[model samples]
Target: MPAATRERAIEAAVELLGAQGVRALSHARVDARAGLPPGSSSNWFRTRRALLGGIVDWIAEKERADFDPAAMPVITHLDELIEGLCAMVELQSGPYAARTRARYALFVELAGDAELGEPLRRQRREFERWTERIVTAVGITDPVPATRAVMALADGLLLHRLTVDPDLEVRPTIERAIRALARS
Candidate 1:
């Protein structure tokens, strides 16, 4: 029941994130959306930042958990990788898009805060691990630089999408970037 309440809070937060971004996320809003009494979120999560962190952890864990090495299809060509990423983008809409946008926003907000810096660094390292595997599977050696580039492109694309068109399909841009990376 406690877990259910926590998840409800996350769901509410994700919805608000999608509609209004992180600027509008608050315990009162989540409580109202989740149908819980005001201050219930405080019982589960102490601070607003803690709630944001929990939401980030929840989203990241779900995405990472779905990542199965054995299920990954073998890719020998760059187009295959592009196809794979497009599929991912297609599958990862709704709450995931909001979650992604919230993460990028939170990163900017917490970048200079010494308290949250280490956790953000750890999350970045985990993302690097996942990106490195993808870059390697794309048949690239020296995936570190390529991984960084892809990450930067992905971030840029997300920012663009969030700020411009929430309904934007970024797969084509990613496909073009993949071709460019292959040429380099």
Candidate 2:
């Protein structure tokens, strides 16, 4: 199959997963969603697991597509961290909403399938490690736990925006969390 078709299928799968849920994902569904003929997705992925794995890989690539590894940004101060995290929350819940939602859907649906979900798990760990560097530099007392707390809070806020309140103001909430942490 052509790479464009393959990518289209993966993109469609992500949309299906995001718009509906995990149970909505299938080769045929992706094909239909992509406006490709029957068997188009199967021609590339061949299995639901393959498509899902492909989706994870695609998401990881898109997430870090323009990220520069050597140019690690410095979150030198609490206010800087607050602003940076708020921007991240906006990007994750705004332009990347569908993909982010698809990623979270996969995380929940495939939590028990370590074999199939390893890529997603690995991506998360890698994100945490990257987050650790920023938090550590910012002088968070225990960077590891702080990373977890920040990630969890951000994710919760994202979920709330995605699921319940599309107009939720995330910056204040993030600022509050960071301020409370700073006071500790």
Candidate 3:
């Protein structure tokens, strides 16, 4: 199969997973959603596991494209880090909301299936490492712990905003949290 076709199928799977959960993901469903010929997705991903892995790959690629640290400016202050993080939050809540939902859905869906959780774990570690880099660049003395704390804060805020408070303004809140963390 062509790489573009495979990518399209993966994108469709992500959309389906987000809109209808894991149960909605299937080769045929992905083919239909992607507007490809019948069995096209199956030709690329012969099993459900393969399909899920493809989705994970797609998510990782999208994230890397969205936030390339090499392309980012140097962070000189806590507020700068806050601004970058706030932009990230905004991205998740805006155009990438569906993908974010799909990711969390996969997390829940794979929670009991250790074999299928590898891709998610890899993606998460990538995120954590990137966060650590940012935290370190902000002059945090203990970046490892600070990175974990920042991740927890961001995750909690994202969950709250997505589930309980859709209108939550997170910039100020995240800025304050980062400032406190930087000082600690």
Candidate 4:
């Protein structure tokens, strides 16, 4: 299959996973959602596992595009960290919101599926490592715990925005949390 076709299918899969759920993801569904002829997705992904794995890969790709480390400023101070994190939250809450929703939905779906757990965990570890780098750059004494705390705060903030308050002003909240974490 063409790479563009494969990418389209993956994008469609993510959209389906977000708009519907795991049950909504299938070869036929992806093909239809992607506007490809029937069997196109199956040609690219032979099994449901392959399809789901493709979705994970696509999510990583989209996230990398959304959050490029090279494009970010060196976060040497708490204020910079706050600014960077607030920007990230804005991205997650705005343009990439559906993808975030899809990611969490996939996480819940993969919890019981042993076959899909490793990829999800690997993706999470990559995010944690990225967070660790930021924390370490900000002169945190214990980068690991700081990274975890920041990641937890980000997750909670995103979940809150998704569930309870879509219009929540996240920058102030994230700034205060980062200040507290920096002092700790």
Candidate 5:
């Protein structure tokens, strides 16, 4: 099969994982969901681990695709960073909800597999580095820990939005926390 076939499979796999959690994922299910010939996913991935790895890469790519490091300088004010982060939270919980759900599923599902988790770890480290750079540019003294804490806060809020209350008005909270982090 070609790259499109692989992409379709990954996309369909994310849809499946999002709609029904990990139990819904299978080669045949992915093929049917993608409208590809039977065995297409297995043909490309060859193993369950390989399939999960592909899924991680796809989700990570989708997550990072919209972010541009050059945009960091544009956030000359704390309000700008707050707005950007709030927008990100909105996107993750709204338009990209399914992919976000699938990404979370994979995070928990493969939490114990060090080898398989490397891709996830790599994605997270890159995100943190970028966040640290943005924080450093904003003159945050403790960019390292501040970046980690901010990321953790975002993740927690995303989880809460997805799980507890989908209607959470996150802007005020995000603004307060970001401003406090920026100050500290």
Candidate 6:
């Protein structure tokens, strides 16, 4: 499928899924949300599972772009990482915020389902790779604990933002964690 069409389908699906849960994201609904024809979603996405798989990939790609580790300054990688994380939390107010929240929700909900497990596994693996890269860049000799710390912090912050409140600040918390990690 063409990149544009696939991206549109995934975007629409995410929005619809976010607003109404995964059960409401029918092919026709996705097409309507995406402003495409009735069969466009079905033509582009064969099934809801396929559309969700595309969403997983799309979320990974967008997160990677938004948190571009290479774009950070070489010296203050910790600060840069913190800034990237803060920016992500702040993205809760952006145009795609609903999609972001829905994607995570779907990820957790479908994690145990056999049909979506593979895609979730791939998504998590990709996230781990990114986490490992940040750890390595910060010169953390033992990446095992460092990666775990990053994941834990990220997950906590994400949950806090999504569940507790949107205005919740995570920068200080993330910075404190980074400081502790540095001292370790």
Q: Give the whole-model CA lDDT for all candidates, comma-separated.
A: 0.74, 0.85, 0.84, 0.84, 0.85, 0.74
Runs of candidate 4 exceeding 4 Å displacement: 112-115
Off by over 4 Å in 2: 66-72
Candidate 6 TM-score, C-alpha based: 0.78
Compare candidates 1 and 4 on TM-score and give the better one: 4
> In candidate 2, what are the lDDT values of residues 30-139, reduced to their tens digit?
99999999999999887888888889888888876644445546668888888888888888888889998999998998899988788888877888888888877777
Worst 10 residues of 4 by lDDT: 114-123
Candidate 5 lDDT tens digits, 1-184: 8888889999999999988898888999999999999999999999878899899988887767766566544665677778888988888888888898998898899999888777778888888888787777777778888888889888988989988888898899988998898777
Cα error of candidate 1 at position 67, Å: 4.0
Model 6: lDDT to the true structure? 0.74
lDDT of 3 by residue, 106-175 (tens): 8898888777777777878988998898788779879999999888887787777667786789988898
Q: Write the per-residue lDDT of candidate 4 for residues 15-96, one digit (tens) a residue.
A: 8887788888889888899999999999989999888888877887778766767866777888888888888887887778
| Sequence-dependent TM-score of model 5 | 0.90
Error of 2 at 71 (Å): 5.3
RMSD of 1: 2.7
Query: CA lDDT of 46 in candidate 3?
Result: 89
The TM-score values for the models, in the order shown, are 0.80, 0.93, 0.89, 0.90, 0.90, 0.78
Candidate maximizing TM-score: 2
**Model 1 misplaced regions, further than 4 Å:** 68-71, 92-95, 114-120, 166-171
Please say which candidate is ahead in TM-score: 1 or 5.
Answer: 5
The window of 10 residues in a row where model 3 has the poorest summed lDDT is 158-167
Error of 5 at 3 (Å): 2.4
Clash number for model 3?
Answer: 0
- What 10-residue stretch in candidate 2 is worst by lDDT? 66-75
Ranking by TM-score: 2, 5, 4, 3, 1, 6
* Each model's backbone clash number: 0, 0, 0, 0, 0, 0
